[model samples]
Target: MITCQDILELQLDGVELIAGEEGLDHPVTWTYMVQTRPFAEHMNQGNFALCVIDYVRYDFEEAQRAMEELYELGISGFAVSVMEDREWIPQKMIDRANELALPLFYIRWEGASFVDIAQSVGKIILEHEIQNKRTGDYLYNLLFGYDINDRYIEKISSQFGINFTNPCRVGIIVADRRYGINLEQDEHIYEYYANYLN
Candidate 1:
Protein backbone atom coordinates (compact mmCIF):
# COMPACT_ATOMS: atom_id res chain seq x y z
CA MET A 1 0.00 0.00 0.00
CA ILE A 2 1.72 3.17 -1.16
CA THR A 3 0.43 5.79 1.26
CA CYS A 4 0.30 9.55 1.85
CA GLN A 5 2.94 9.14 4.54
CA ASP A 6 5.21 7.39 2.03
CA ILE A 7 4.84 10.30 -0.38
CA LEU A 8 5.66 12.86 2.30
CA GLU A 9 8.74 10.87 3.28
CA LEU A 10 10.10 11.55 -0.19
CA GLN A 11 10.53 15.19 0.94
CA LEU A 12 9.94 16.65 -2.51
CA ASP A 13 11.10 20.26 -2.90
CA GLY A 14 8.71 22.90 -1.49
CA VAL A 15 6.17 20.28 -0.51
CA GLU A 16 4.94 20.16 3.10
CA LEU A 17 1.98 18.87 5.03
CA ILE A 18 -0.18 21.66 6.46
CA ALA A 19 -3.09 19.68 7.96
CA GLY A 20 -4.62 16.26 8.48
CA GLU A 21 -1.61 14.74 10.23
CA GLU A 22 -3.78 11.85 11.47
CA GLY A 23 -4.60 10.75 7.91
CA LEU A 24 -1.00 10.33 6.84
CA ASP A 25 -1.45 6.58 6.48
CA HIS A 26 -4.17 6.92 3.82
CA PRO A 27 -3.21 4.63 0.92
CA VAL A 28 -2.60 6.35 -2.44
CA THR A 29 -3.37 4.31 -5.59
CA TRP A 30 -2.59 7.08 -8.10
CA THR A 31 -2.15 10.85 -8.66
CA TYR A 32 -4.69 13.30 -10.11
CA MET A 33 -4.39 16.88 -11.28
CA VAL A 34 -7.53 18.93 -10.54
CA GLN A 35 -7.94 21.60 -13.19
CA THR A 36 -11.66 21.60 -13.88
CA ARG A 37 -14.78 22.13 -11.81
CA PRO A 38 -16.65 19.12 -10.38
CA PHE A 39 -13.27 17.49 -10.02
CA ALA A 40 -14.74 14.69 -7.95
CA GLU A 41 -16.20 13.19 -11.09
CA HIS A 42 -12.70 12.77 -12.54
CA MET A 43 -11.24 11.29 -9.35
CA ASN A 44 -11.42 7.80 -7.89
CA GLN A 45 -10.75 6.19 -4.55
CA GLY A 46 -7.14 6.40 -3.28
CA ASN A 47 -6.19 9.19 -5.69
CA PHE A 48 -3.83 11.88 -4.45
CA ALA A 49 -5.18 15.16 -5.80
CA LEU A 50 -2.81 17.90 -6.96
CA CYS A 51 -4.06 21.37 -7.75
CA VAL A 52 -2.92 24.91 -8.39
CA ILE A 53 -5.07 27.38 -6.50
CA ASP A 54 -4.91 30.03 -9.20
CA TYR A 55 -5.72 27.57 -11.90
CA VAL A 56 -8.79 26.32 -10.04
CA ARG A 57 -9.87 29.89 -9.14
CA TYR A 58 -11.11 28.61 -5.82
CA ASP A 59 -11.84 30.86 -2.90
CA PHE A 60 -11.45 29.60 0.67
CA GLU A 61 -15.08 28.45 0.91
CA GLU A 62 -15.00 26.78 -2.49
CA ALA A 63 -11.73 25.06 -1.69
CA GLN A 64 -13.24 23.75 1.54
CA ARG A 65 -16.23 22.43 -0.36
CA ALA A 66 -13.95 20.73 -2.88
CA MET A 67 -12.00 19.13 -0.08
CA GLU A 68 -15.17 17.76 1.47
CA GLU A 69 -16.24 16.33 -1.87
CA LEU A 70 -12.82 14.77 -2.39
CA TYR A 71 -12.94 13.26 1.07
CA GLU A 72 -16.35 11.77 0.35
CA LEU A 73 -14.90 10.31 -2.85
CA GLY A 74 -12.17 8.55 -0.82
CA ILE A 75 -9.34 10.67 -2.12
CA SER A 76 -6.13 9.75 -0.29
CA GLY A 77 -4.78 13.30 0.00
CA PHE A 78 -4.86 16.86 -1.41
CA ALA A 79 -1.89 19.01 -2.43
CA VAL A 80 -2.33 22.63 -3.42
CA SER A 81 0.20 25.01 -4.88
CA VAL A 82 -0.56 28.64 -4.14
CA MET A 83 0.15 31.81 -6.06
CA GLU A 84 2.37 34.48 -4.56
CA ASP A 85 -0.50 36.67 -3.30
CA ARG A 86 -2.13 33.93 -1.19
CA GLU A 87 1.24 32.81 0.25
CA TRP A 88 -0.44 30.08 2.39
CA ILE A 89 -3.55 27.98 2.65
CA PRO A 90 -6.46 29.42 4.56
CA GLN A 91 -6.59 28.58 8.27
CA LYS A 92 -10.29 27.66 8.06
CA MET A 93 -9.60 25.16 5.30
CA ILE A 94 -6.82 23.69 7.41
CA ASP A 95 -9.22 23.36 10.35
CA ARG A 96 -11.80 21.62 8.16
CA ALA A 97 -9.15 19.21 6.86
CA ASN A 98 -8.07 18.40 10.41
CA GLU A 99 -11.66 17.72 11.39
CA LEU A 100 -12.15 15.41 8.42
CA ALA A 101 -8.77 13.69 8.89
CA LEU A 102 -7.97 14.29 5.23
CA PRO A 103 -4.32 14.87 4.50
CA LEU A 104 -3.75 18.36 3.01
CA PHE A 105 -0.45 19.46 1.59
CA TYR A 106 0.99 22.81 0.47
CA ILE A 107 3.43 23.07 -2.38
CA ARG A 108 5.32 26.30 -2.83
CA TRP A 109 5.17 27.25 -6.50
CA GLU A 110 8.51 28.99 -6.59
CA GLY A 111 10.71 25.92 -6.84
CA ALA A 112 8.36 22.93 -7.04
CA SER A 113 6.79 21.20 -10.02
CA PHE A 114 3.58 19.17 -9.95
CA VAL A 115 4.98 16.91 -12.69
CA ASP A 116 7.96 16.02 -10.51
CA ILE A 117 5.76 15.19 -7.53
CA ALA A 118 3.41 13.10 -9.65
CA GLN A 119 6.28 11.21 -11.25
CA SER A 120 7.91 10.42 -7.89
CA VAL A 121 4.63 9.09 -6.50
CA GLY A 122 4.04 7.05 -9.65
CA LYS A 123 7.48 5.46 -9.38
CA ILE A 124 6.89 4.42 -5.78
CA ILE A 125 3.54 2.82 -6.63
CA LEU A 126 4.99 0.95 -9.62
CA GLU A 127 7.92 -0.37 -7.58
CA HIS A 128 5.64 -1.54 -4.79
CA GLU A 129 3.41 -3.36 -7.31
CA ILE A 130 6.41 -5.01 -8.92
CA GLN A 131 7.67 -6.20 -5.55
CA ASN A 132 4.22 -7.66 -4.77
CA LYS A 133 4.31 -9.58 -8.09
CA ARG A 134 7.74 -10.97 -7.22
CA THR A 135 6.52 -12.08 -3.80
CA GLY A 136 3.50 -13.77 -5.39
CA ASP A 137 5.73 -15.61 -7.84
CA TYR A 138 7.94 -16.85 -5.00
CA LEU A 139 4.91 -18.12 -3.11
CA TYR A 140 3.62 -19.87 -6.24
CA ASN A 141 6.95 -21.64 -6.69
CA LEU A 142 6.98 -22.74 -3.08
CA LEU A 143 3.52 -24.29 -3.47
CA PHE A 144 4.05 -26.08 -6.86
CA GLY A 145 7.80 -26.51 -7.40
CA TYR A 146 8.92 -30.11 -8.11
CA ASP A 147 12.20 -29.98 -6.13
CA ILE A 148 10.94 -28.40 -2.91
CA ASN A 149 13.15 -29.16 0.11
CA ASP A 150 13.63 -28.06 3.74
CA ARG A 151 16.37 -25.62 2.73
CA TYR A 152 14.18 -24.07 0.04
CA ILE A 153 11.26 -23.70 2.42
CA GLU A 154 13.44 -22.11 5.06
CA LYS A 155 14.93 -19.67 2.56
CA ILE A 156 11.56 -18.63 1.22
CA SER A 157 10.10 -18.33 4.71
CA SER A 158 12.92 -16.07 5.87
CA GLN A 159 12.98 -13.97 2.71
CA PHE A 160 9.23 -13.28 2.69
CA GLY A 161 8.67 -13.05 6.46
CA ILE A 162 6.34 -16.06 6.44
CA ASN A 163 6.10 -17.96 9.71
CA PHE A 164 5.90 -21.45 8.18
CA THR A 165 6.99 -22.92 11.52
CA ASN A 166 3.36 -22.64 12.66
CA PRO A 167 0.47 -24.74 11.44
CA CYS A 168 -1.01 -23.70 8.11
CA ARG A 169 -3.70 -24.85 5.67
CA VAL A 170 -4.47 -24.15 2.01
CA GLY A 171 -7.98 -24.07 0.58
CA ILE A 172 -8.74 -24.69 -3.10
CA ILE A 173 -12.01 -23.88 -4.87
CA VAL A 174 -12.86 -26.11 -7.79
CA ALA A 175 -15.37 -24.61 -10.22
CA ASP A 176 -17.47 -26.95 -12.33
CA ARG A 177 -20.86 -27.33 -13.91
CA ARG A 178 -23.57 -27.11 -11.27
CA TYR A 179 -27.32 -26.90 -11.82
CA GLY A 180 -26.81 -26.24 -15.56
CA ILE A 181 -24.48 -23.33 -14.84
CA ASN A 182 -21.17 -24.15 -16.46
CA LEU A 183 -18.27 -22.02 -15.08
CA GLU A 184 -15.93 -23.28 -17.80
CA GLN A 185 -18.27 -21.95 -20.46
CA ASP A 186 -17.48 -18.39 -19.29
CA GLU A 187 -13.84 -18.01 -18.30
CA HIS A 188 -14.43 -14.36 -17.39
CA ILE A 189 -16.76 -15.36 -14.57
CA TYR A 190 -14.27 -17.88 -13.27
CA GLU A 191 -11.47 -15.32 -13.45
CA TYR A 192 -13.60 -12.74 -11.66
CA TYR A 193 -14.18 -15.13 -8.77
CA ALA A 194 -10.53 -16.13 -8.66
CA ASN A 195 -9.42 -12.49 -8.49
CA TYR A 196 -12.07 -11.69 -5.93
CA LEU A 197 -10.95 -14.55 -3.71
CA ASN A 198 -7.33 -13.61 -4.14
Candidate 2:
Protein backbone atom coordinates (compact mmCIF):
# COMPACT_ATOMS: atom_id res chain seq x y z
CA MET A 1 0.00 0.00 0.00
CA ILE A 2 2.41 2.68 -1.10
CA THR A 3 0.74 6.07 -0.79
CA CYS A 4 1.08 8.97 -3.17
CA GLN A 5 3.65 10.55 -0.87
CA ASP A 6 5.63 7.36 -0.99
CA ILE A 7 6.14 7.99 -4.67
CA LEU A 8 9.25 10.18 -4.77
CA GLU A 9 9.16 13.61 -6.36
CA LEU A 10 10.36 13.68 -9.98
CA GLN A 11 11.27 16.27 -12.60
CA LEU A 12 9.03 14.69 -15.22
CA ASP A 13 6.14 16.74 -16.56
CA GLY A 14 3.61 14.24 -15.26
CA VAL A 15 3.13 10.69 -14.07
CA GLU A 16 -0.44 9.45 -14.03
CA LEU A 17 -1.69 7.96 -10.79
CA ILE A 18 -3.80 5.34 -12.44
CA ALA A 19 -5.92 4.04 -9.57
CA GLY A 20 -3.56 3.78 -6.62
CA GLU A 21 -4.73 2.28 -3.30
CA GLU A 22 -4.14 3.80 0.11
CA GLY A 23 -4.61 0.73 2.28
CA LEU A 24 -3.31 -1.97 -0.03
CA ASP A 25 0.41 -1.59 0.57
CA HIS A 26 2.61 -3.97 -1.34
CA PRO A 27 6.35 -4.74 -1.49
CA VAL A 28 9.11 -2.20 -2.36
CA THR A 29 9.92 -3.51 -5.79
CA TRP A 30 9.20 -0.15 -7.34
CA THR A 31 11.92 1.64 -9.33
CA TYR A 32 11.00 5.31 -9.58
CA MET A 33 13.45 6.07 -12.36
CA VAL A 34 15.01 4.44 -15.40
CA GLN A 35 18.52 5.96 -15.39
CA THR A 36 20.23 4.08 -12.58
CA ARG A 37 23.89 5.13 -12.75
CA PRO A 38 23.19 8.88 -13.04
CA PHE A 39 20.70 8.82 -10.16
CA ALA A 40 22.84 6.93 -7.70
CA GLU A 41 21.77 9.62 -5.25
CA HIS A 42 18.07 8.79 -5.45
CA MET A 43 17.25 5.34 -6.79
CA ASN A 44 20.52 3.70 -5.87
CA GLN A 45 20.85 0.02 -6.69
CA GLY A 46 18.97 -2.13 -4.13
CA ASN A 47 18.93 0.74 -1.62
CA PHE A 48 15.13 0.63 -1.30
CA ALA A 49 13.84 -2.58 0.29
CA LEU A 50 10.63 -4.57 -0.05
CA CYS A 51 8.38 -5.19 2.90
CA VAL A 52 4.81 -6.23 3.87
CA ILE A 53 5.12 -5.04 7.46
CA ASP A 54 2.84 -2.29 8.61
CA TYR A 55 3.84 0.87 10.42
CA VAL A 56 4.56 -1.17 13.59
CA ARG A 57 5.41 -4.70 12.49
CA TYR A 58 9.15 -5.50 12.48
CA ASP A 59 9.76 -9.19 12.01
CA PHE A 60 12.57 -10.72 9.97
CA GLU A 61 10.76 -13.99 9.08
CA GLU A 62 7.92 -12.21 7.31
CA ALA A 63 10.34 -10.07 5.36
CA GLN A 64 12.34 -13.10 4.35
CA ARG A 65 9.30 -14.95 3.05
CA ALA A 66 8.03 -11.91 1.19
CA MET A 67 11.40 -11.33 -0.38
CA GLU A 68 11.66 -14.95 -1.40
CA GLU A 69 8.28 -14.79 -3.06
CA LEU A 70 9.22 -11.56 -4.78
CA TYR A 71 12.49 -13.01 -6.10
CA GLU A 72 10.81 -16.17 -7.32
CA LEU A 73 8.28 -14.03 -9.16
CA GLY A 74 11.10 -12.62 -11.36
CA ILE A 75 11.24 -9.03 -10.15
CA SER A 76 14.57 -7.28 -10.70
CA GLY A 77 15.40 -3.58 -10.39
CA PHE A 78 15.13 -2.99 -14.13
CA ALA A 79 11.96 -5.08 -14.44
CA VAL A 80 10.19 -3.47 -11.49
CA SER A 81 11.00 -0.02 -12.86
CA VAL A 82 9.37 -0.89 -16.16
CA MET A 83 6.27 -2.13 -14.30
CA GLU A 84 5.75 0.93 -12.09
CA ASP A 85 5.35 3.32 -15.06
CA ARG A 86 2.52 1.20 -16.35
CA GLU A 87 -1.02 2.19 -15.32
CA TRP A 88 -1.57 -1.15 -13.63
CA ILE A 89 1.43 -2.85 -12.09
CA PRO A 90 -0.35 -5.34 -9.76
CA GLN A 91 0.62 -6.20 -6.18
CA LYS A 92 1.87 -9.57 -7.22
CA MET A 93 3.77 -7.84 -9.99
CA ILE A 94 5.18 -5.40 -7.46
CA ASP A 95 6.30 -8.26 -5.30
CA ARG A 96 8.08 -9.56 -8.36
CA ALA A 97 9.68 -6.15 -8.87
CA ASN A 98 11.01 -6.25 -5.32
CA GLU A 99 12.60 -9.58 -6.03
CA LEU A 100 14.24 -8.18 -9.16
CA ALA A 101 14.79 -4.53 -8.26
CA LEU A 102 13.35 -3.38 -11.59
CA PRO A 103 12.86 0.31 -12.41
CA LEU A 104 9.54 1.86 -13.46
CA PHE A 105 9.01 2.15 -17.21
CA TYR A 106 6.26 2.55 -19.80
CA ILE A 107 4.82 -0.55 -21.46
CA ARG A 108 3.62 0.91 -24.74
CA TRP A 109 7.26 1.00 -25.81
CA GLU A 110 9.75 -1.69 -24.70
CA GLY A 111 11.22 -3.09 -27.90
CA ALA A 112 13.82 -1.80 -30.37
CA SER A 113 11.37 0.12 -32.53
CA PHE A 114 12.14 3.85 -32.25
CA VAL A 115 8.53 4.72 -33.09
CA ASP A 116 7.00 2.78 -30.19
CA ILE A 117 5.53 4.29 -27.03
CA ALA A 118 8.19 2.72 -24.80
CA GLN A 119 10.88 4.46 -26.80
CA SER A 120 9.06 7.77 -26.54
CA VAL A 121 8.62 7.38 -22.81
CA GLY A 122 12.23 6.28 -22.43
CA LYS A 123 13.44 9.38 -24.23
CA ILE A 124 11.50 11.63 -21.87
CA ILE A 125 12.66 9.75 -18.80
CA LEU A 126 16.28 9.74 -19.91
CA GLU A 127 16.18 13.47 -20.62
CA HIS A 128 14.79 14.30 -17.20
CA GLU A 129 17.27 12.01 -15.54
CA ILE A 130 20.23 13.57 -17.37
CA GLN A 131 19.03 17.12 -16.71
CA ASN A 132 18.67 16.52 -12.98
CA LYS A 133 22.12 14.95 -12.76
CA ARG A 134 23.75 17.72 -14.76
CA THR A 135 22.15 20.42 -12.63
CA GLY A 136 23.12 18.70 -9.39
CA ASP A 137 26.71 18.24 -10.47
CA TYR A 138 26.98 21.78 -11.74
CA LEU A 139 25.60 23.24 -8.54
CA TYR A 140 27.88 21.11 -6.41
CA ASN A 141 30.97 22.19 -8.34
CA LEU A 142 29.89 25.82 -8.33
CA LEU A 143 29.61 25.75 -4.56
CA PHE A 144 32.89 23.89 -4.05
CA GLY A 145 34.77 26.00 -6.63
CA TYR A 146 37.74 23.75 -7.32
CA ASP A 147 40.04 24.13 -10.31
CA ILE A 148 39.59 21.08 -12.56
CA ASN A 149 42.15 22.14 -15.17
CA ASP A 150 44.96 21.68 -12.65
CA ARG A 151 44.38 17.94 -12.69
CA TYR A 152 45.17 17.90 -16.38
CA ILE A 153 48.33 20.05 -16.18
CA GLU A 154 51.17 18.89 -18.42
CA LYS A 155 54.63 20.14 -19.38
CA ILE A 156 53.66 21.87 -22.64
CA SER A 157 49.89 22.45 -22.66
CA SER A 158 48.06 25.45 -21.17
CA GLN A 159 46.22 24.36 -17.99
CA PHE A 160 44.33 21.35 -19.38
CA GLY A 161 46.98 19.58 -21.48
CA ILE A 162 45.91 20.53 -24.99
CA ASN A 163 49.01 18.78 -26.49
CA PHE A 164 49.57 21.60 -29.08
CA THR A 165 49.12 19.27 -32.06
CA ASN A 166 45.32 19.42 -31.89
CA PRO A 167 44.97 22.56 -29.77
CA CYS A 168 41.42 23.13 -28.60
CA ARG A 169 39.29 23.42 -25.52
CA VAL A 170 37.13 20.57 -24.26
CA GLY A 171 33.74 20.21 -22.66
CA ILE A 172 31.07 17.56 -22.32
CA ILE A 173 28.72 17.41 -25.27
CA VAL A 174 25.30 15.82 -25.07
CA ALA A 175 23.22 15.65 -28.22
CA ASP A 176 19.66 16.87 -27.84
CA ARG A 177 16.92 17.53 -30.40
CA ARG A 178 19.21 18.40 -33.30
CA TYR A 179 21.51 20.25 -30.92
CA GLY A 180 24.41 19.51 -28.58
CA ILE A 181 24.14 20.39 -24.91
CA ASN A 182 27.64 21.45 -23.84
CA LEU A 183 28.45 21.78 -20.16
CA GLU A 184 32.01 22.95 -20.68
CA GLN A 185 33.04 24.64 -17.45
CA ASP A 186 32.05 22.01 -14.91
CA GLU A 187 34.78 19.62 -13.80
CA HIS A 188 32.84 16.45 -14.43
CA ILE A 189 31.74 17.76 -17.78
CA TYR A 190 35.30 18.75 -18.63
CA GLU A 191 36.58 15.41 -17.48
CA TYR A 192 34.15 13.65 -19.75
CA TYR A 193 35.08 15.88 -22.65
CA ALA A 194 38.79 15.58 -21.95
CA ASN A 195 38.66 11.83 -21.75
CA TYR A 196 36.53 11.66 -24.87
CA LEU A 197 39.00 13.84 -26.78
CA ASN A 198 41.97 11.82 -25.63
Candidate 3:
Protein backbone atom coordinates (compact mmCIF):
# COMPACT_ATOMS: atom_id res chain seq x y z
CA MET A 1 0.00 0.00 0.00
CA ILE A 2 1.12 3.56 -0.69
CA THR A 3 1.69 5.07 2.76
CA CYS A 4 2.58 8.27 4.61
CA GLN A 5 6.13 6.96 5.08
CA ASP A 6 6.42 6.45 1.34
CA ILE A 7 5.40 10.08 0.77
CA LEU A 8 7.97 11.21 3.35
CA GLU A 9 10.69 9.34 1.49
CA LEU A 10 10.06 11.53 -1.55
CA GLN A 11 11.60 14.29 0.56
CA LEU A 12 9.73 17.08 -1.13
CA ASP A 13 11.52 20.34 -0.39
CA GLY A 14 10.98 21.77 3.11
CA VAL A 15 8.33 19.22 4.08
CA GLU A 16 8.95 17.43 7.36
CA LEU A 17 7.03 15.22 9.71
CA ILE A 18 6.37 17.09 12.95
CA ALA A 19 4.28 14.65 14.97
CA GLY A 20 2.71 11.20 15.02
CA GLU A 21 5.80 9.48 13.77
CA GLU A 22 4.29 6.13 14.70
CA GLY A 23 1.48 6.72 12.23
CA LEU A 24 3.80 7.00 9.27
CA ASP A 25 2.57 3.59 8.15
CA HIS A 26 -0.95 4.92 7.55
CA PRO A 27 -1.98 4.08 4.01
CA VAL A 28 -2.48 7.07 1.73
CA THR A 29 -5.06 6.28 -0.91
CA TRP A 30 -5.34 9.84 -2.19
CA THR A 31 -4.10 13.38 -1.62
CA TYR A 32 -6.14 16.57 -1.20
CA MET A 33 -5.23 20.24 -1.16
CA VAL A 34 -7.49 21.66 1.51
CA GLN A 35 -8.05 25.44 1.58
CA THR A 36 -11.46 25.73 3.20
CA ARG A 37 -13.18 25.07 6.48
CA PRO A 38 -15.33 21.98 6.98
CA PHE A 39 -13.04 20.31 4.50
CA ALA A 40 -13.51 17.01 6.27
CA GLU A 41 -16.85 16.65 4.52
CA HIS A 42 -15.10 16.39 1.19
CA MET A 43 -12.45 13.99 2.45
CA ASN A 44 -12.53 10.24 2.82
CA GLN A 45 -10.58 7.63 4.73
CA GLY A 46 -6.93 7.23 3.63
CA ASN A 47 -6.79 10.80 2.31
CA PHE A 48 -3.63 12.78 2.98
CA ALA A 49 -4.63 16.43 3.39
CA LEU A 50 -2.41 19.38 2.52
CA CYS A 51 -3.09 23.00 3.33
CA VAL A 52 -1.72 26.24 4.68
CA ILE A 53 -2.01 27.15 8.35
CA ASP A 54 -4.21 29.93 7.04
CA TYR A 55 -6.97 27.36 6.81
CA VAL A 56 -7.31 27.85 10.55
CA ARG A 57 -6.41 31.54 10.36
CA TYR A 58 -3.44 30.71 12.61
CA ASP A 59 -5.84 30.31 15.52
CA PHE A 60 -4.95 27.54 17.98
CA GLU A 61 -8.58 26.65 18.65
CA GLU A 62 -9.38 26.33 14.95
CA ALA A 63 -6.30 24.22 14.37
CA GLN A 64 -7.26 21.92 17.23
CA ARG A 65 -10.79 21.52 15.92
CA ALA A 66 -9.60 20.78 12.40
CA MET A 67 -7.12 18.16 13.55
CA GLU A 68 -9.73 16.49 15.73
CA GLU A 69 -12.20 16.36 12.85
CA LEU A 70 -9.59 14.97 10.48
CA TYR A 71 -8.67 12.26 12.96
CA GLU A 72 -12.30 11.26 13.37
CA LEU A 73 -12.69 11.11 9.61
CA GLY A 74 -9.77 8.63 9.30
CA ILE A 75 -7.62 11.05 7.33
CA SER A 76 -4.26 9.35 6.83
CA GLY A 77 -2.16 12.43 7.50
CA PHE A 78 -1.98 16.24 7.35
CA ALA A 79 0.58 18.65 5.88
CA VAL A 80 0.40 22.32 6.76
CA SER A 81 2.51 25.07 5.24
CA VAL A 82 3.45 27.70 7.77
CA MET A 83 3.63 31.33 6.85
CA GLU A 84 7.04 32.94 7.22
CA ASP A 85 5.93 35.10 10.13
CA ARG A 86 4.32 32.28 12.05
CA GLU A 87 7.21 29.83 11.48
CA TRP A 88 5.67 27.16 13.68
CA ILE A 89 2.65 24.97 14.19
CA PRO A 90 0.79 25.32 17.46
CA GLN A 91 2.12 23.05 20.24
CA LYS A 92 -1.39 22.04 21.22
CA MET A 93 -2.09 20.88 17.68
CA ILE A 94 1.08 18.82 17.68
CA ASP A 95 0.20 17.26 21.02
CA ARG A 96 -3.30 16.41 19.80
CA ALA A 97 -1.94 14.85 16.61
CA ASN A 98 0.46 12.66 18.62
CA GLU A 99 -2.40 11.59 20.84
CA LEU A 100 -4.46 10.63 17.81
CA ALA A 101 -1.48 9.03 16.02
CA LEU A 102 -2.36 11.04 12.94
CA PRO A 103 0.82 11.94 11.06
CA LEU A 104 1.31 15.71 10.92
CA PHE A 105 3.72 17.32 8.48
CA TYR A 106 5.16 20.80 8.19
CA ILE A 107 5.95 22.63 4.99
CA ARG A 108 7.79 25.92 4.69
CA TRP A 109 5.56 28.42 2.92
CA GLU A 110 8.14 29.23 0.27
CA GLY A 111 9.19 25.64 -0.18
CA ALA A 112 7.31 23.02 -2.18
CA SER A 113 4.16 24.07 -3.99
CA PHE A 114 0.99 22.14 -3.16
CA VAL A 115 0.64 21.17 -6.82
CA ASP A 116 4.10 19.62 -6.79
CA ILE A 117 3.37 17.59 -3.68
CA ALA A 118 0.03 16.43 -5.02
CA GLN A 119 1.45 15.45 -8.39
CA SER A 120 4.35 13.56 -6.85
CA VAL A 121 2.04 11.64 -4.58
CA GLY A 122 -0.31 10.96 -7.49
CA LYS A 123 2.54 9.57 -9.56
CA ILE A 124 3.57 7.20 -6.79
CA ILE A 125 0.02 5.92 -6.44
CA LEU A 126 -0.26 5.42 -10.20
CA GLU A 127 2.99 3.52 -10.34
CA HIS A 128 1.92 1.30 -7.46
CA GLU A 129 -1.38 0.53 -9.24
CA ILE A 130 0.41 -0.26 -12.47
CA GLN A 131 2.73 -2.67 -10.69
CA ASN A 132 -0.24 -4.36 -9.08
CA LYS A 133 -1.92 -4.76 -12.46
CA ARG A 134 1.18 -6.34 -13.90
CA THR A 135 1.39 -8.77 -11.00
CA GLY A 136 -2.29 -9.63 -11.49
CA ASP A 137 -1.69 -10.35 -15.15
CA TYR A 138 1.15 -12.73 -14.24
CA LEU A 139 -1.06 -14.60 -11.80
CA TYR A 140 -3.88 -14.83 -14.35
CA ASN A 141 -1.50 -16.27 -16.87
CA LEU A 142 -0.27 -18.86 -14.34
CA LEU A 143 -3.84 -20.00 -13.79
CA PHE A 144 -4.89 -20.21 -17.44
CA GLY A 145 -1.86 -20.29 -19.72
CA TYR A 146 -2.15 -23.09 -22.30
CA ASP A 147 1.60 -23.72 -22.60
CA ILE A 148 2.34 -23.96 -18.88
CA ASN A 149 5.50 -25.97 -18.12
CA ASP A 150 7.83 -26.46 -15.13
CA ARG A 151 10.41 -23.96 -16.47
CA TYR A 152 7.73 -21.38 -17.23
CA ILE A 153 6.13 -21.86 -13.80
CA GLU A 154 9.50 -21.54 -12.08
CA LYS A 155 10.33 -18.37 -13.98
CA ILE A 156 7.03 -16.74 -13.17
CA SER A 157 7.14 -17.79 -9.53
CA SER A 158 10.69 -16.48 -9.06
CA GLN A 159 9.96 -13.23 -10.83
CA PHE A 160 6.97 -12.49 -8.58
CA GLY A 161 8.57 -13.84 -5.36
CA ILE A 162 5.80 -16.36 -4.83
CA ASN A 163 6.51 -19.76 -3.26
CA PHE A 164 4.94 -22.02 -5.79
CA THR A 165 5.92 -25.07 -3.78
CA ASN A 166 3.58 -24.12 -0.94
CA PRO A 167 0.11 -25.61 -0.72
CA CYS A 168 -2.53 -23.25 -2.06
CA ARG A 169 -6.23 -23.09 -2.60
CA VAL A 170 -8.39 -21.18 -5.03
CA GLY A 171 -11.65 -19.46 -4.18
CA ILE A 172 -14.54 -18.38 -6.33
CA ILE A 173 -16.77 -15.44 -5.46
CA VAL A 174 -20.27 -15.33 -6.90
CA ALA A 175 -22.01 -11.97 -6.70
CA ASP A 176 -25.77 -12.01 -6.60
CA ARG A 177 -27.75 -9.05 -8.00
CA ARG A 178 -30.79 -9.61 -5.87
CA TYR A 179 -29.94 -6.54 -3.78
CA GLY A 180 -29.04 -4.32 -6.77
CA ILE A 181 -25.55 -3.35 -5.69
CA ASN A 182 -23.60 -0.49 -7.20
CA LEU A 183 -20.62 -2.24 -8.76
CA GLU A 184 -18.76 0.95 -9.53
CA GLN A 185 -18.87 2.25 -5.97
CA ASP A 186 -17.96 -1.16 -4.53
CA GLU A 187 -15.07 -1.83 -6.91
CA HIS A 188 -12.47 -0.78 -4.39
CA ILE A 189 -13.98 -3.05 -1.77
CA TYR A 190 -13.57 -5.91 -4.19
CA GLU A 191 -9.95 -5.01 -4.73
CA TYR A 192 -9.40 -4.87 -0.98
CA TYR A 193 -10.83 -8.35 -0.58
CA ALA A 194 -8.79 -9.67 -3.44
CA ASN A 195 -5.58 -8.35 -1.93
CA TYR A 196 -6.51 -9.68 1.47
CA LEU A 197 -7.20 -13.09 0.01
CA ASN A 198 -3.98 -13.13 -1.93
lDDT of each: 0.78, 0.34, 0.77
Worst lDDT 10-window in candidate 3 = 176-185
Candidate 2 off by > 4 Å = 1-18, 21-115, 146-198
Task: Order the candidates by lDDT, highest first.
Answer: 1, 3, 2
Tens-digit lDDT track of model 1 for 1-198: 688999999999899999999999987878988756676556667789987777347665666677788788888999888766365787888998899888999998785798999899989988876766677688888778897888878877787677677787776767542434443334534543343233
TM-score of each: 0.79, 0.24, 0.81
Q: Show pairs that collide, candidate 1.
A: none
Q: In model 1, which runs have C-alpha deviations exceeding 4 angstroms? A: 161-163, 166-198
Ranking by TM-score: 3, 1, 2
lDDT of 3 by residue, 96-146 (tens): 889888899988878888888999998998887777777888888877879
> Using TM-score as the measure, which candidate wins?
3
Q: Is candidate 2 or candidate 3 better by lDDT?
A: 3
Residue 87 lDDT in candidate 3: 53
